[model samples]
Target: MIYADKTDLIYSLASTRARIFLARPRRFGKSLLVSTLQSLFSDGLKYFSGLQIEKLWSDRQYDVVRLDFSGLKIFENLEQFERDFKSVLLEAFSPLGFNINKSRENIVFFDQFKSWLLTLPPDSLVLLIDECDTPLTSHLDDDEAFDVIRNHLVKFYTVLKSAERCLRFFFMTGITKFSNTSIFSALNNLTDISLDTKYSQLLGLTEQEISLHFEDYLASAEKVLRLDRNQLQNALRENYDGFCFDRKAQNHIYCPWSVLNFLNNPEEGFLNYWYASGGQPKVLLNYLKKHKLANPFAFDEPRQIRLSELTAAREYKDIGIEALLAQAGYLTIRSVCSNGYAELGYPNKEVELSRAQLYTEELLRGKNLDPMGVPMLSELIETGSLEEIVARFNAGINLIDYQTFPITTEAASRACIQLFLMGAALMPEVEKHTVLGRSDLEVRAGKRHWVFEFKYAAKTKDAAQLLEAGREQMRSRRYGVGPGAGELHRAVLVFCGETRRFERWLEIEDAAD
Candidate 1:
């Protein structure tokens, strides 16, 4: 098949011979990109009479060696994993006619391979390694096994650092960057292009790229979804639209597999392409069980954690939640603080909603349905009627078993308000470094915006007073700035308690003079 436009990454490879480290989330076409590069430089282009790389290298071809550790049982157990890996390498090079003249005994196979790579056609040799972090992550449960595998990988990669003259270019890819000097210390010269903006769309498909590639699919999609082209675009955007390689880039990209699958099966809303990459559910379940963390509905401020701290390889089964989540593609480091701290969170709406649904079901298993009080609140907010919301709140509180965890009346009220706000209100979606301050809920629908201040109280009068206070807080905080200046919308307060609480919901439109 003809390769799509990944001219940026290919251009990088062609422009320089430096060792490259490309870290992209899995199924972002890392393997395909590597394969394209291999075909370009290697002798596998016998059929490439008119491909992109053929246009550039019509006269140039070189010896290529590809190593895919992805299929290796690197996570199974350390000794067996290494032994199997030694065999895979021997088999990989044996077909390439490299001299395996030394005793076939199970010695340091990497050492033998290094000696052979040096004797190759100098700059004509390119080495590509894929899924290099598999070993480290797989053996994390077994420290001794992990250490042994880590040393082997380190020794192997470090050889590339010294064999500068023997290599034309070296490309390595993984879902996560290995911590400290475990394996990455081996290749000190490798430039990490994971966060480089130049090749942001190199592996993933941008909206423009998708539209251009599957123009035929769009017409079919529009017809099937009963949406016009623009509406179809908007629907696709809402579901799988938030991902961009550049933080500021507007070229929202969708997962290639998901898009294609949607094209193939137009009836599906959103398929689990993120999980389809494999092994995420197991990792998430493991982390959740270990941490005992809940509250997946609301967003939490990012936390700072060190790579060395994660690699300590002790306690909590030697796996850090942040590290595993980052690597498994569930969460991403949104920004790096000036103090060298990393802020991490869900990358997009697709991930956020799916994660919430999964975590909520897991944690709230066997919990009463009254815990989720948003449906009733939505009715009250949409119709400006408080009767239903009040009834639901009281019903939940009156029937509270409260045996699992000590629940304070105030805390329950706040949680009830949170559940309502989270589901009923449409929050201003923030991305990357844009800090969203704490507020009950910020809702925007069409031209109307609502800032809610919820106050749950035991008495109706106190609830009303608390509601007024919350409105004042909104005004004092300058909740919405700039564009909607003087366009202040409504501030609402909601109170729920044993004694009928008096709460007021005020409609504040853009105060036009």
Candidate 2:
């Protein structure tokens, strides 16, 4: 079910400034929204009959030029990209009855396009450019090619500013927001509504929209899953919802792509549909590697950023990772602070699990560890075999080559355990704070509660002392004393001189125990 009904967007589109730029993560329906606008501007109201927009929209026809820059392969060099770019533009405009002289230069094409625009009636043309950042994103690794594409886009967009009088409306959609000094420098009139509260729900599915559109699916899923309607809805929300564009807006939106995929095959359980389709962007991976980001699994704290920070170019290394992740749709606003800061985190389980898998692969690269070993850690936890989990962790740690500075062997070891448990959907909580102190890791498997405390010992003889200290800390902090803390398994993990050991001292027996 397509739960997005953004007919109200038409009101904003008509009343706002003519130049508009909207950026959203891929598969969040940017292209679909563009198609809707195309139909609306073309006076195809019949397509939207019985929808909210049908009553609010005015029937008017305009000369619409819709250009989709997606699916164009990035060429090896600037010369090749320019050739392909010109060809793509020509192909897009050819259907509009524009016969133009062939030009490889973007400026030349824009000039020709402007001249053609003059031939049409004033204020009768609508321009929609979809996936406008594909050229830059596809060539992110090549500085020369990226710059060439950015310059070309800047030149082309300048024409929009210059031909303002000839256009009735201009809308551009893309995944990333390039800085003003880049493609949008000349198109100063373009207003970014990506974070505007009025349009936050324009592309994604709001909860009400999901209920309205997928009522039948929800009812059927309740019966099939043997759950009540509310239970089914909550499960769906936990798995596919939690995307908050406007922190002040009470309604959280669901990723339309994941929701639809779940509805298509509810019996298959919740899969990483959107993440599996696109995975992590190569550019994002490259940046994380370059920056040596140690922890990629969590972003719970709210990061403070100015609106300008959001649009700032990626060239600035100081730009926070939180901003990039949020813009890329991996992280989203969880809450808004009074100080104007937007707290961000993974939108849902689909994102968290997929990111955990990606991070695990990144962490274990070239370690000679079996790829299947990660899942085995989860299996050991589920089976409540403490010995096997420790043995598996020690083996994995031994394979990893340790470094002295940032991200040492110990840190990597802890991160590996956390990520493996998370990948298995075990709900591992790291650095959990309690009244006494913070626990290293706390996880649940069935009725068993496992609390781990990690310690490092420089000498082999100190391993026992460190392990005992970890146990004492766990006991003093009462890490395993909460409700349903059934069958608490408290363990201390010690690392010393290329050796690892696990010692369990306390076990609060469950009723069965």
The sequence of per-residue lDDT tens digits that candidate 1 reaches over residues 235-294 is: 666656554444323333566655666777777755555654552544356456656454
* Count of steric clashes across candidates, in order: 7, 1
* Model 2 lDDT, full chain set: 0.70
Which structure among the candidates has the greatest lDDT?
2
Q: Which window of 10 residues has the lowest lDDT sum in candidate 2?
A: 504-513
Per-residue lDDT tens digits for candidate 2, residues 222-340, read 77778898888888888888887764745578888888888878888777888777747655675676676645333333455654456555563454777777777777777776776
- Which pairs clash (backbone N, Cα, C closer than 3 Å) in model 1? 456-495, 459-501, 460-501, 460-502, 464-502, 489-508, 490-508
